[model samples]
Target chain A: MDEPLLRIVDVWKSYEDLQVLKGVSFELAERDVKVIFGPSGSGKSTLLRCINMLNPPDSGEIYLRGDNITAPNVDLNAIRTRIGMVFQHFNLFAHLKAIDNVSIGLRRVKGLEKQEARRKALEALNRVRLAEWADHYPAQLSGGQQQRVGIARALAMEPDVILFDEPTSALDPELIGEVLQAMLDIAKAGTTMVVVTHEMGFARAVASEMIFLDDGVVIERGTPEHFSVSPKSKRVKRFLNQLDVLYGSHEKLLKLSEEEEGK
Target chain B: MLFQTELEFIGMGIVNSIIIFPISIYIMRWYSKKKDMPHIQLWDTSLKTAYKVSLVWLMVNILIGILFNTFAKNITIYFLIQYYVYMIIDLFIGTIVVKSIYKKELGESFMFVFIIQVILFGIGLIIGFITVLLLGYIFPEVSDVFFFVLEFGLFFTLLITASSLLIGFAIGISLAIMRVYGGKELHWLSSGYEKLFRGIPLLVLIFIFAFGFPGLFWYLESLDRLLASVIMALGLRSGAYQSQIFRGAILSVNPGQMEAARSVGMNKIQAFRHVVLPQALRLAVPGWSNEYAVVIKDSSFASAIGTFEMTFIAYIWGLRSVELFTLSMGVVAVLYFLFTFPVTRLFGERQTKKLKKLGMGGG
Candidate 1:
């Protein structure tokens, strides 16, 4: 029971000629919030995909509550139900409306009755402030609204951990705020999360532990304050320097990135 | 029965069918209007619509019949003229009415109604043929009762095509899934089936089932089994072509949809059923409609093996007057065109409209 809720042990995955993730490993504790940020092509998204075995690691193991999930004998679907994921592209089922998108897994995977599943779906949408748009299709909504519906869909599963892979990367600038705000509320509610994003403000505010992933490896891990002030790696310091310009609005993150780069 | 000869009976059938057409339409229309019979009423709507189309078509056929009767002297020429005339009306008038019946936004749930009507019409035609045959039997058998054979032969064309299309659709969808998502072995199996069925001619395949296979299998020698064999062979061959249509539709669904479904904890099969196939099937409607047109065309070859569909009956009728064979064939080609063109265009139009709502109308 004292063990972390989710653990990835030396996971590695390569697609054809591209090695997406190289020997990445981490542990996520219950009720803890994590935000991973890195440059493009840094394997941040691949690591998140590997966590749910959507792109299963070519080697090594993933354990959920001490069960080896990467084993061939394990049911990937059952394991996935315990750990939900949100993609960069808000891939909602077009044929179904927003509510049914949230309720489908509830009916098919959870075996819930129609009314119960629908009620739960509406409740999940309510959390994202999308209950009013329940009957609308994904095409009818904006990018931010669609991403919020995506979060609600994952949240409806009530998984042990939810992974967000650049969830706001595809949203319009104005829409990113709403999606991030919904995510911030989820973090405040103490749900476990692993989010990959460049939104340093969200990370600074809600992240309990932040990690810099680069070259398919975890370059640095610390509190947002600790990472901002003094990241040990020169590469991480340099990346944080660029983030300094990205997060110029945040005085603390700017001062830290500047101070560390100056050092 | 009042006709002096078989040729006169042919003439009388046109007159009687024209008269019976409106009376049948009236009764069917009144029955459809009855309250509190939802199941019957549901079917009655399509049937009434069909009756209206047939009524218009019958009038046209009568006009052509009257024109031809002034020049006709034999049963063979009468049979060929009447068949060609009816087929033309069915293609033009029937197609338009059926298309109009489906003009509203149709949910996938209503697909069963469309399919059931085809099956029911096949059954209706058979029942009507049997009724005519019984009426003739109860009376005396005149030597020139060739009109009965002609009617049965014409109706049999529709029956075989309907059955083969239904079977081919089922087989084609399965083959498509196998090709798209199945493993290496299953993929090879489906590919092999498609290649084998599509490569050779439909006539060759039909002959294999009707004549070649029956020699090896004792049960296939039976008359019913022989009929089943012919239908199955046509359907199997059609399935190969149908598979390509389905595969194209399945591929048109974006790869991201599958990933989205998986991210939500649905397995491959559930994801396909929930996310992929529903969308793919809608997109496939145009292709599937073309497959139906092809089934009618290809199944006409079933006549070579004595399956007794349109092409074979046309050939036999043409043979009766050898000098007019070329003229008969030219008319048959026109008849084929009317039956296929309009209905397929309607399918493409409706599907395009539905797909436009989904924002995928360009392709």
Candidate 2:
């Protein structure tokens, strides 16, 4: 690919004694949807959090659009303005109404006027099909609706790349579809995205490339079909096998036969 | 003779009854409307009117007593009749005026009733004076020290209670801020201050500050014993309790709010101003009111310091006349109730409403 829109090189992060990410490396072209897949504790979420400095890597270089974000001289606020993050817990400001929550960063950080920021907020909410809930507080909305507002808030910043750290992980089973559908809409709009999720079907359907992580390292990175059909690393194979047992596979009989024989 | 005396008492009582009762009620009703009714305004107005009426009646009774001693030989029965009569008349007139205003289609014009009451009461006072003068000739010597104590004592106590509460609130809120946001050293200092003050009985705290502090401080030795000792002791002790009220309020603010504000490019001070302090201060109001009640009652500690605040003044004057002591204490008790009872009630109700809105109240 011509120069990648984003490149993460040998990124390493730890929290005290626990090393969560170990020399993780990745690259993304403009408008690519990269899905990171792994069992829980695989550091997929922490890696995504590191890209935007929400959890800055202890040692790594993350360049966005040719700027070295990991460099100490880079204005992190300015960098954050161009890189948006959606949290797993949907940490929307509890006291603010949906629209105000979306507009807050715009008005305060981007210097948008109240009316203009609200208009942009409405537009972002409309993109997520949550325009009707714009004036309602988070407490008044359902979990799915609140997640959508969170997405709207992230989108209002108009970042170059969106990072999602298990966006639907905290959502109810029935509510998961609504948040995923909103994410699918974002992907269709052609924004660059990096998502850490256990949702294999979404990975299979939407991701241009998939990275399988285990114990803080990327074990396999390939096309979704390649990973699904013929994962090279034994770790990837075993991880996918366990996921198959948990979710049950939709793959053709050949893969099932292999899985059963391996079991 | 008993029938004639009772009839004359009842007859003279009518005018006094009308003047006192209606003015009190009308003032209360008018006050209630301005303050959004059934809340602060209601209590403030009623208490204010009660104080005014008590003061005016005290002066009138004392004057009448003095005049009777000079001009009429037998004024005791007349004074007793006047006291009861004026009380009844004031109640009656207050009820009529309040009810009339309540029934009127005057929109917001009800406020004018306060001005009208003052004007009417002034005219009524002149009329009452003339009537009393004419009646004095017939009834003779009908006002006494008992009447003077009732009126003056009530007004004096109300003034003391209200001033103490206001001062307490101001000191309490400020000290609370100092306790909460005043740096690590200040926080420790304020915490110690709060514990020391709130831990000690309010009476002891007041006494020590009022009596002990002055005795200990050489510079203060030359100052007026009563003024210096009482103000310093009461104000300092109040600051300690107020600080606790504030600290609790500030802590109640969510830490998330401060983080959110900082993420939005606000500095620590701006974050506190915009997001944290406003919500914390609102939450602290009921607690602050409780501390205010303590302050009002605690002001009585000034009496031990030898300040001639209401309780002290009453005690000094009461010692000479036991009747005055009973009347003075009654007036002071009523004044204290007027100052604190309604505030506590109002804050309690508002706190319930706030809790309800926050989804923290009853199931």
Candidate 3:
């Protein structure tokens, strides 16, 4: 009933023979951490990409704070600048250094001066605890470091909402924690984000609302406690069984499950 | 049995060849190493290192022939045949040595080096026949035009290669973008332009421009149509190839890169300019250098249109003394090789270093 920062309605997308996304819809409120999870071929990444018009939904109306961004002749670049995306591959420009990777869009798209962009980029990098690696190229950095750089790049945009397309998926098992920590810090800062990830701990801790998407449809969407305790759909209950192993039945997760059960 | 004279001749030539190698390859490596050469990144492996070893072998043989006059005491038919036979054996042995040392990357191109050797030997045979078998029949006036054409010819050949490559490279890059990223009409236009220019021979193009087009312009008598037509015809043909080089280079850039840039809010063109083109240009270096060699070689066809370039100079010298035609052509080919070989090798080295800096191997 409250106003939403970003809203999508009945999106459909097909690539040649593949109907990658069906009638999908969602909404993001300001300062909301909405975590979406699904198995492979669930179209989670495609849906995130569509929100920023990177994939440009074949049929859907996307409204940003009330203005319809999906209209035929909208300024896609302006709309995109307000919606940052972090990729699964961490798509940091290989040729540019970490700081430059964060600063370039500020300079180019945001029309910030060199010093201003550098300051903001450094601030963002510091936010991710990667200020020291500012001069290092993406290729020179490790997987987790690169993913942190990717997050810093997104944060530098200061977009209305950030889209995380499995940002930690490419990191080594040991490396995923640092990226998650950086992401958790960003989430605590109250930047609206729509994350598509398998990190169930992140969802339980940071996500105000959690969703289960399967075959491009939202099977379940609720507060983390509600979703965990009841998980209305049978598919979700079955899917939650597989995910608990991935979520690592650690102490924090065990505590979370207990809290949700009590709720 | 190797004679002291033949051995000394080649041995001094080897020393000379050593000096020449640095001048050609090192300078080239230094000059070309900085540019974003498309896929010209060479793997700095022992296999590719053999390119230097084998080049040394090939150059020494050419040097032996050039310095042959000092060892020209016996000019019998059997002697010339024996010298060629031994030279062939040395080249073959050199190939084996290179093979034994490394064979991964160099093996395929090593065959091309062998084919060049065969072509060189064929040229040597023709030169031998003209100078030794038909020496008495050659007119003395042939020497009169030799120094003049050789001096002026080298200068103009360099000028033509520089001008044509500069113009072609610029135009080719534009055309490549059109074919790669342009709308349907521009894509069709670029492809059509590439096909039209590439399908027609440079000789035919020069003739069309030089003989056919000069009638339209009033001030043509003052301008150097020979130079103009040679550059225009060759430059246009080169643009077609350059476009392909750039197109391939642009394609080599990962698609994710453009998507990443676009996700950051830069439009299609900005994403291409910022993210894709830099990587693509690096990938294009090898292809760019090949196109460079092709342009220089094609510049030889300028002689057919009377451009007074090196080959045309060689043609004039040949006609002056018909028997010396192959000898004159050999002189031009040696110079052509001198000009072309270093450029390709230097640019090749630079590409590898650049690729390495980008955290990729000289692949």
Candidate 4:
């Protein structure tokens, strides 16, 4: 097998006395889409942040393309450039317009010239269908449009993988679909992603693998089909059912997954 | 001319004592009333009110008489002796009157008399100061003094205020960053510096910089020592205050701002410079203007060290006589107000509107 594009080994993290992640391990091959879901405090977001060292894991190692990012003296900023992040709050730089927001990293970190960065930023905006909203400040944009700009910001970096930490969680219900659609387009383009969300329909449509985290440990890991059809753990089945009821009908979720699989 | 000066002094002294006597007693009565003292009948007996009035009257006359003899030209030793004899007589009567009126012990009545004397002097100076300004308008000779103060004094004041504000703002930004984002040692050091400077009076600091340091290190002496010391003292004090302003503005920014910047692959310093600092500065504009006003007023303290700023110039020209002193102070006060008001309005109101337009949060 070709070496996994990213690997997490025995990751453990704690905040003071409370352990947030316990011996969680995972791997992602190139162009893989992993969907992570659990109760709010299950450390799914923590794990994603650890991958980029935003919140460094207390004990364990993370490797990106076989480089040990967890080791001392590793350049974390350089590592972060290759691992994009989309926050739940859609943390767009409030001072900059959408175009500048997407272009800042490209110009600052990537050493791209002004025109080149602008062109690439526009291209990324177009990808997220936010090209016309490029000149608007984050405050002027709707919640959905802001999230799309956030995604474009991450995508412009051409990172190996993007981590979406509940991207649609802060959006109004009507606005969630547009952002999810943008994420779907990115997934279809074969960009590697790890998304932490409870949107069962989106998970059903694009997840290459599904992970269920509880009490800071992975309770279930399987193919998308394994989760919908015959998850081994009873807790996994119960969680999917709950998520399905909250997000949509199980039949509808299954139908979406089947149609995407066929495609 | 010498006889006229003495008579003028005596006349002004009588007028001041008459005006101050009633007001001081009324103020003292109001204060004692606030302290929940029992309503003593102040006017029931003719003797007590007469005593209170005369006690204040005699004190002001004696004090102003001595000032006149010392400051006015060609006042003979005979008049000085006459004022002393009256002061001794007044002191004897003042204690008896205060004790009988307030029904207080000897020490407390002495304190009461002292308090009334200070109030009389303060009020007397203010009235004299304004009278000189009025006299300047009527008399052509006095306006020359006003223009002299405006020309020579205004320049040094502007120099002190501007340079100190610049130095302070720069140091303030550095110190604020250290207090906010720096690690254990830096945070401690910056905070300690702020506490030490803010706690020490600016006058004491000026003295330290001007005399103490140069005395300890002879090589530190320079021709511009007084001016430099004034700037150093004012700048360092302003820096302590401005640091707090900037620190507050920095913290007012959403923490998510720094996190977002870092997530974009910029290091902490880059993130602070690009994302946090701009927003913090915009929020700091109002506070920065307030610091400007405070530093401008504080520039007056430079007069103590004899930098030729307006107040120092005021003192020099003022020393020719008491009337000149009053006129010089009035001019200095007006000039300081003029320097501070317009700039504060420009920054405080207009920049705030601009910040609002940009959608930057916080006042």
Per-prediction DockQ comes to 0.49, 0.13, 0.47, 0.37
lDDT of 1 by residue, A54-158 (tens): 888999888899999999899889889998889898888877899999999999889999999999999999999999999988878999999999999999999
Give the per-residue lDDT of model 4 (tens digit) for B29-114.
66666776554443222233444545465555545554654576765647635654654466456656666766645553454454
Each model's C-alpha lDDT?
0.76, 0.68, 0.77, 0.81
| TM-score head-to-head 2 vs 4, winner | 4
Position A54, candidate 4: lDDT: 87
DockQ computed for model 1 against the true two-chain complex using alpha carbons: 0.49
What is candidate 4's local distance difference test score? Answer: 0.81
Q: Provide the clashing-pair count of each candidate structure.
A: 0, 26, 12, 0
Clashes of 1: 0
**Across residues B91-161, which tens digit of lDDT does each residue of candidate 2 receive?**
44554454464443433333444444455555665576676566556544222222332333333233344
B-chain TM-score for every candidate: 0.59, 0.54, 0.59, 0.59
State which docking tier applies to candidate 3.
Answer: acceptable
Off by over 4 Å in 2: A1-5, A241-263, B1-273, B282-286, B306-363
Higher-DockQ candidate among 1 and 4? 1
Stretches of candidate 3 off by over 4 Å are A16-20, A246-263, B1-150, B216-218, B317-328, B359-363
DockQ score of candidate 2?
Answer: 0.13
Instruction: Please rank every candidate by lDDT, starting with the best.
Output: 4, 3, 1, 2
lDDT of 3 by residue, A16-84 (tens): 889988898888889999999988898998898788888889998889989899899899998888888
Correct interface contacts retained, every candidate: 0.60, 0.07, 0.65, 0.51
User: Can you write out model 1's per-residue Cα lDDT over B238-314, one digit (the tens) per residue?
Assistant: 78988898888888888888987887788999999988998888888888888878876776676666666556656
